[model samples]
Target: MEKTYTRFEHYSGDRTYQNEQLVEQALANSDFDQAATQGKGFCRLLDKAYIFQDEKLSEYSIVIYTLDEPGLLDSAAKREYVLSEHDEMIIHRMAVVRNGQYLDKADDVQIRILDHEEQGGRGFLTNRKKLSLIIKDLHLQDILIFENTLVSHAPQAGLKRDFKHVYQEFPDPFWFYDRYVLRTVNQTSQVMTYKSCFFRDAQHQVIDPIAIDLPIGESYVFEADNFTTDYDPKLEVRPFIDFATKASYSKVSDAAYQIYEKVISQNSTWLETSAPDLLVELAQHETLDEKIRFVIEFVQNSIYYVYDAEIMDGHEPQEPQITYESKQGDCKAKTVLLKSLLDYLDIASTCVLVNYEADYFIPFYCPSPSNFNHVILKIAYQGRHYFVDATSRNQFGFLQYRSVPEFMYYLPIEPQADLQFREPFWHQNYLVEETVTCMVTEGVGQIDHTLLLRRQNADAIRQMFKNESETYLFNCYTTSLYYNMCLTDNFSEKELSEYFTDSKIAIVSDNQDLNELQIQHDVTLLKPYTVRIGKKEYLNYWDRTYLDDKARDFNSRDLPFWLSHAREKLTFELRTDRKINDKEKVTLQECKIDSDFLCYQTTKAVDKHGARMTIDYSVKTNAAIKGEELANYLSSDKKIRDNNFGMTIDLFEQGFFDKLKKSFVKK
Candidate 1:
């Protein structure tokens, strides 16, 4: 593969042959009347067409563009397209329009095909590669034109193989990209259907998907002009049409389910050899949930995640015995094995396909096997079923307690199963529980912080300890200690590092019976009283910097924020031996806030020797807030924040005068 792309000016692929006559026809049909923007580079014409023929879908595209400035040369020359091993791309023509003439450079264009090395580190055993088209001598004011076609070699004619994707806007800031047409010709006789999803346009208005049935010949066509670039990362609705054959949803679902069952049935000898040992191991747990936990751990910890090229191709999963014996499999492979184990235990479980990232949009899509990108299992333990990812590691708990992916929509492999939805709920009470105790002993502040993590937080931190050392943990906490002990903006960088370097952190406990991780961190502040620029130092509270910092990340965005850090509860307490209260009877100030999705409260009390301000904060819900509800959430946050206590300091200024009087006599 490397050798094929080593030569600079040659074709990188031998799979697709070029047709000159077809290329000329495509170019001649791409004439645009709209004038290009004068100052910037822009695409004058783009023609993308798809043909569903002979049980396969082929994609062909033609693009013509020009650049006026030399600044756009690098970007113009380095145009690229990502391709997987299952997909083939062929370039039919490449030429430049110089003086109203086509200077053909199709054979001499520089081409480079590079494989993805980073995917290996992410545990996605993929043969995905990139194809780069490096046009040589790409100069100013010269129109560059190219034609290409793509086809997937995967078995699309089988049980699950139809899809349609659409884009209303481009990513590039082209001056004029409206001269574009996207067409699909269904050469097959099957009647394909598609659904509509609305997109938000530049004026903040919704653009509903245009559903146009193909001509009487049943060919679907979509054409658009003046497509603008969408810059918001949160805006992610891509209008699409579905072209799956009018096959029944249940039929497709059952066909895929049968393949999984067949793999287990044909490999009966595997169970004969492997089941007895697994059963003997499962028997040690004595309880059903524990037995299930054992099997899940066995798959997660024992079977490694290695995504082969065949993953998610709607193909048959490997035999359970094979995955169990090899201790390595993709999402589908590990999931099938886990499902088999549950089956052997007389536990009912089903396979689910999800897009781990954008699962929230799954139910909106038409029924098709091509929608999902990842596979997991939904186990029925006790009386309920919840998702469990086989590719996850170090996750241990009951079904709901396990820290699994926050999946929204799923397609079950059960017979007649349509799309399924998972309500956004945190099965466990607390994703993270932490207690910060500040003790003022002998005129110094000794802070003790203990964190108890469950669910996803626990699993994540456990892996942190597995991959990082205690020293690394302390370095991370140093920043936290700095912000907690001193006013953030009041201290210099050197002062922060000098004062907080003495912090100590240790993983006090881990996987306590493989359930949760408990960590302890301690920091001692020698000069707890410090008001910058004053030799007389003092303690200050109500910094509110941390609260403002967290809110700043979403101050202006309208995207439905993904709430991964929700369901966390934290408590901070301060204690000291000094006498500051005048009498035994003292007053306490408190503010309680209960919002739509969270609860927060702060209490301040002064003892005889010292004062303590305790803040209890928790995000109660896991559901994401839609854009319409964002302003209300922010308003509620403001109400809670505004009730905060004013910044207060100890009687440090008065003590500073006492220290000066005692300094001359004591020395």
Candidate 2:
């Protein structure tokens, strides 16, 4: 049985080639037919118009030459050729001619001629003419080694090959590039050879392979040079119509306008008198606070967030009528409804496409819709723009979580509206206040803490907590300890069942030595601060620093908000004030005993007494003393957020109660 060989030609320009006859003729050749029957000789055309070898071949050479017009190579017409090899070969401009036929098994013989961009002439090795193929051990190793050494030793070399690629911009858009190579190999051996071009451009762009068919033990080398280009800043921003906006509101395109016109045309007096403009009418409320509060309540109570299912159901962008039909949608739907309400009221609003996680307000030269996975609304009122995200709960007025920053928002004002993105704003501060009081009786302790927070900085803290909770469980340890170990609340009780429902249990203890302990803490943040659970035990563990991955690496200097001990302006106080009041005069001696910052320990007397129980207590929180000055005398390692000082009181009014709990019994 005879196999067949098929040859295809690739050419640049916008035209098609009918090569059926040429392919049929080529298939008739005995060698071509032999190769084809063996499932070896198959070829595909590329953009640059050249004959390439596609099938695997271990003991064969691939000869590809650019064709003339009409995609055909005429060797007799003008004797003009880009690259041609006939009785000899050239590697890096170094010609090598075999004196005799070089024949041997093709095992362990690998050759790779990578296609690259090299405009100027480049070469390293001179011609090594009349070479010999030293073959041995049923392997074509010597001849292949001789061939590779000549090219590897060369300094300046270039290859000849190019592949074609299709660049698509989605929904009826495509561009093309020519870049690829021809491969050859023997049928019995796994070794292979690649012939391609040499490119000088460092920014190497290549053709996409339809399917890779390389077998085991085959290798390829690609030589890509540095090609650089200056970016035209004008390409940074583009205008994409987000129809859900005040400007886009019209009877033709917007659903709200259509509904409004239809309702009014019916001559319904009730709708005319009761129906209010949804946009500017709301903004005209007597107070900004009222408008904000209304909007928050309307969105939070009215809409339910459904994520995965909504996106997966292939829901199209809802028209105003459709949104009103469901009375709820996802983020996009919520945004559109809000926009319509504001639009009816004549409020200026714009719907922005965003990748909530990516932070669109931050300058990203690579503008991509993929980066923006979510959407938000920006409303302008009283010469100020407010960012409204209805996806969250408990948000009011202009209050944003600490995780949001000035740069994470994109107003998406008209395309012509000069909006230059900037990096995250630094130097923002957060203030948090917490007050805790603990009362311990016998082995049981009861504590109460009140915390107040103020928004004073970029919302980094809120975002930090979100990030930690989602991935690393930053506050898990503190919450768990309180619910489990501290016995602040009983696990079997029904009153506080909701407190620890979200947390997973790690350990359970039923030790009878444990006393009933109650602890309550209230913490408030005026500004978003990364929520710290209890202390900075695992500072960097599980914290994914995207700033490092997206832009530059992180360093200490990059942490501009870092706190230092010397610069700390903080106060933390603990005190126990004891005073005994006497009612029956002289029956029992009246005394008032109080101590601040008390500590208990066993001590040895130096003079005569060997051992004694010692109690050391001191009072330092005078309310008048400067927090910074007081911190100097306390533990240097401990710190409190803001200048808030802590105070604790543990007084023993009667020794009998204490003695009852202890082993000592009065005789």
Give each model a TM-score.
0.82, 0.34
Q: Which candidate is the best by lDDT?
A: 1
Q: Compared to the true structure, candidate 2 yields what TM-score?
A: 0.34
lDDT tens readout by residue for model 2, 1-667: 5211111122222223233322332223232223223433222211111111222111112221122122121221112111111112222111111222232223322232222222222111221122322222321111111111111111121111111111111111111111222222122122222222111124533222222233433432221111112222232212111100012112111332232233222322232344345334455767555665465446645666544322412223454445555656666667666666555445777766444443532222122222244556677777855567766553333323212323333425233332323332222232333333332223233333432333321122333444565324314433432432223323332323243333332212111111111223332211111123442110000111101121122122111111211101111121212222222221122122232221111121211101111112222211111133323323221221111111112122435655574645433
Highest TM-score: which candidate?
1
Q: After aligning candidate 1 to the native by TM-score, how far in Å is the CA of 254 from where it should be?
A: 3.5
Question: How much RMSD separates candidate 2 from the native structure?
Answer: 23.2
Candidate lDDT values, in order? 0.63, 0.29
Q: List the candidate 2 regions with Cα displacement exceeding 4 Å.
A: 1-288, 304-317, 344-347, 360-371, 381-384, 393-411, 422-432, 439-444, 453-573, 576-667
Candidate 1 RMSD to the real structure: 5.5
Query: How big is the positional error of residue 440 in model 2, measured in Å on the Cα after superposition?
Result: 4.9
True lDDT of residue 182, candidate 1:
68
